[model samples]
Target: MEKFEFTKPELEETEGILNHLRDTINDTLKPDDELRLREQLMKAIEEGHIQRDVFGLNPVLQALRTAQIAVDEIGLKRDGVLATLLFPLVINGHQTVDDIENKFGTSVAHIIQGLVKIHNLYEKNPIIESENFRNLLISFSEDMRVILIMIADRVNLMRQIRDTEATEAKKEVSEEASYLYAPLAHKLGLYQLKSELEDLSLKYLEHDAYYMIKDALNATKTSRDAYIKSFIGPIEEHLTAAGLKFHMKGRTKSIHSIWQKMKKQKCNFEGIYDLFAIRIILDAPVEKEKMQCWQAYSIVTDMYQPNPKRLRDWLSVPKSNGYESLHITVLGPENKWVEVQIRTNRMDEIAEHGLAAHWRYKGIKSEGGIDEWLANIRSALENNDDLQLMDQFKMDLYEDEVYVFTPKGDLLKFPKGATILDFAYHIHSNIGNTCVGGKINGKAVSLREQLHSGDTVEILTQSNQKPKQDWLNIVKSSKAKAKIRLALKETRAKDGLYAKELLERRFKNKKIEIEESLMSHVIKKLGYKETSDFYKDIAEERLDTNTVIERYVELRDHDSGVRQAESAENFEYESPNEQFTRKNDDVLVIDRNLKGIDYKLAQCCHPIYGDDVFGFVTVSGGITIHRRNCPNAPELRKRFGYRIVKAKWDGKGSSQYAITLRIIGNDDIGIVSNISNIISKEDKLTMRSINIDSHDGLFSGNVVLMIDDNSKLDALIKKLRTVKGVKQIIRI
Candidate 1:
């Protein structure tokens, strides 16, 4: 890599941003490391072709600003800073993974690569299904810094969105941020970022609602300030008397959050209560933090009537994201509800900055806090088999967790609504495979029983019991489902193999080679989608051997051009010993010799060579062949049984029979051309004519084709059915 010199104007802007970033992290970063980081940032900007606009705001400049925010606000380290700086180059297609890894180290390069993969997934599958979204989280789990950088990047984008002129683009970005990024920020415990992202997104997505709430909040600000002062005065005095050093602040809810409450409650803005919260941050040592929080909570609840249902005591057991607070909703003056939150100063920092602040404040690299959560997610991803990878990832990321206890009193957490079978599998696969039922809280229950928090479950197992296919539907965990599917598939594969051996034996007795080609032919003729399905039917005795033999013979004979034909021509009575040789052009082979007999095909049924037929002697015509299942067959057969004559085809030569088919489909442009293309691909059929009519965006057409046999015609019809815009096809 070569270092490029920046122009005087570019150098000035770059130096200014770097100086601000250095000052913010002067205490944290080593002096030499700071200089190196500055050099790397300057080089990346130059190589990336970053330039300042008339207002001195370019992509590179924006990236620097994001880096500054990540350090000063988000509490990120060196790797995160590098990621923020280089993410712009990756997004704009200016740099590759190799370039980043060679110029920087693997740590920074890997983060950028993961971010790029996520970006590509979103771009390629914009209407991302839940499964793909889960995969996005799994990508995030690879490195915690990836998400930190992403949040910082989004915060900067939301801040600059007012400069965007495209209304549609703004709406799309805002909707995505609202639906995905904001919830993610909240889940990660970054309350400040979550609030900002939601407010910015609402400003774009629901402009009217956002402004209305904003204006309402502004109008009430003066009165709200007065109320807050009055409400907190008593609590502040009590806390000061308790000798607790603390700072209190009144926090208004974001406009977006207020709008959400209004919509959810189906009320006007003024009808909503508790639009703001009061926070009491105690300056306490680590040992006294929990005690100080509860003390504040008691003081507030005593001064006002507390809602029992709304009290959340996280001091005992913090959230998975390490959020610890004591929250209580109280009825205050004027019968209005006010939510009060109490936490120590350290807890407040963790709430604002999330995992980064926790790690920085704790001074540990890989600890038991967030790393444990990441480990569990990785474990699920590694063990998953049947369920989609994204689904497993989503389960780990976003699903509500229920904590259950084992018989030994060991607590285990699982996704809410997990069944007893999921519990059994969580213990061990063998235990699940042999599980019959379980006892929840010492009461007998089926495996399908949904476990709730704090329930003690004991799995009952039988040595002879194996997993059933239906267990898949009963279990909610991906692990149990994967195990059940694996067991069933193995059993089914074995059965299929046995069935194949039986079929092969029968084929050998008939002196026919049951090769792959022959198997494909038989499977298709029998209407089986897969060879395994055909074999399974045979092995399970669901298919009759005689039916299989008959179909096989038919397929073999068809391949050899030995079609068994039936005739519908009648002849005058002849002597018992009489015999006659007929020309091969005769469509039907008459049982009785009928030399020079004047006969014609029945116009009503238009019997073809492959059709079943019988002869009917007409008074005017010599004889006419009528199909067995023809519309007039029953009447004719009942009226004149004696006049019927048995007939058969010579089965020696081939000739084309004209057939008309009706087709209907949407009237799309070039639909006829598409149908014609399919017809041209079939070598066994000759398209004689076609007529199409289009009306009201619908097309109806009749196609006239000349085909050799029923099989060829059937194949042609199947092929035509696949053409684009073709809805229906029927032989007329």
Candidate 2:
């Protein structure tokens, strides 16, 4: 590689950036370290360790600009800035890990290594989708600082790509930024970077929409400023009179945000009313911060009519990523809604200058989920459980959350809609497995009770209690749901083993050598679709031991032709080759090889022909066929897992399934008659029942139909959806 000469402008720009970087990190960068940084960087540049991007931008200048962004914007210190500046050399293979570790400290080297690893993964321009998203998190989730640097570089790239001619490449980069980087920025509390990334992404992807919103804001700037002034004037005076020191400013919402509102509400740009917000940052001591913020909030609300639902109180409990503020919306001048944010200067610094600054501050050891997740990562790294780490990251990345308290007043946070069972599992898996119920604020509540913020709960546990399949539906947190599923699997395995032992004992007691294939044939003869199903029934003592053994002997002897010859006419052997039929005499072609097994269709979800279906063996009622996507399938599979089996319709038969459809539509005169007419006109379809209810000009009804196959049902549904007055129709 040939080394390129530095132009005069490049050197001048480098000199300015070097001065800025040194001043920013002056306290931490010693004299010797500063000299080493300048020397090593110049050496790398001279060694041809850099190349210009496709836009033909200078790599050294770009690296310096990225470092400046990290320091000035993200509040990254000496190590962070140095790693950002030196990462390019490693990427170009001019600098090795050992060299970096020796030149800088271990921290800088580790950071650069993470950066290089991510760069290698990004060489193919991979956008992290569902298949690869978890891998991204597990590999780099522990290196959050590295991810932040990557985000900063992406922000710079998006900024510089505006006039570039790489159309397709730019679009791919923009989509990746929107899908991954912007969301990570929001999660990390980088509001400024998050907004910039989003706006730029919109600018590239939806160019016309972005400029439209931007131009609209510019057009209304004069009137909007006047409105903001009118709203803030009295509030500023009121705050000064109350002896509070504060500065107030107003800003319009981001263009991307405005675009999202337009799409979400199905409205035009003019329909957006709350386009701007006023923020009041108070200068107060650490101890008096919350008090002063609340006082300002009161003063603002006293002057304006505040919307109760729009209030968000984060001062009481800060966000997981260390965001603290009180936000409220109120009706300002011209009866227009305006958002107000209240926070102290310290809080504003954390929100603006850096998200990690608050946690890195001297006295703060708390960053609720980050700290917990970091600990989880350390253990996961040791155990090498990539999937578990993925689950852990997913659990913590939920944006909307609910915070609750234990009896000891320890605050715990969970995803919104989390139940008391989730709380118990979060406390401990053993406690969750044995949790019977809980007491919320001195009132006894079931485990299914949804938790609310600030509610103190005490879990009640019993020794005999165990996790049930229904618990999966009760808990909303991923952790609790995962634990319940694992426990159910383990329980099923243990039961299967115990049942195997018991059956072996019975066979030994009878002095009968067990024949594996013959026993399997006997199990199917008893209508068990799975070998485990047979063992499960025997283990639960649902089947009589003597009766099962005698049947096995009869089937075995009959198979050998001795019992068949003894009584050819009166032989009671239930042949395994018997065709499937219901006791009600509804003949269906179920298993092709079977001749006389009793089975019935599940009424909950009618298993029609050409539909995906499965079989579940019943205790005394033989086999029950059900649709694979049946509403009750998850619970049945979780609890009675061993009883589940695979079943398919071998061919069409003389059987009709009763299916129900719930229809909602306009309560027009005789609208129900139209729906009935459509169903009646279809060939081989019969309306079994029609229950209709009408109110407030809308009608909802359940109509039962007898159909032979899924295709007919689907055709009927499509025809019903086309009805004039029908709004929606779905099968139940």
Best by TM-score: 2
Model 1 misplaced regions, further than 4 Å: 1-14, 26-48, 51-57, 90-95, 362-732
Candidate 1 local lDDT, 148-194, one digit each (tens): 67777778777876767667666777777777677667766777888
Can you list the residue pairs that collide in candidate 1?
567-647, 567-648, 568-615, 589-648
Highest lDDT scorer: 2
Candidate 2 colliding pairs, count: 8
* lDDT of the structure predicted as candidate 1: 0.73
Candidate 2 residue spans exceeding 4 A from truth: 1-8, 130-135, 138-143, 359-526, 529-732
Put down candidate 2 lDDT per residue, 54-133, tens digits, no spaces. Answer: 77677778888888887677666777788888888888787887898897888789888888878777776465434344
**What TM-score quantifies how close candidate 2 is to the native fold?**
0.56
Candidate 1 lDDT trough over 10 residues, lowest sum? 575-584
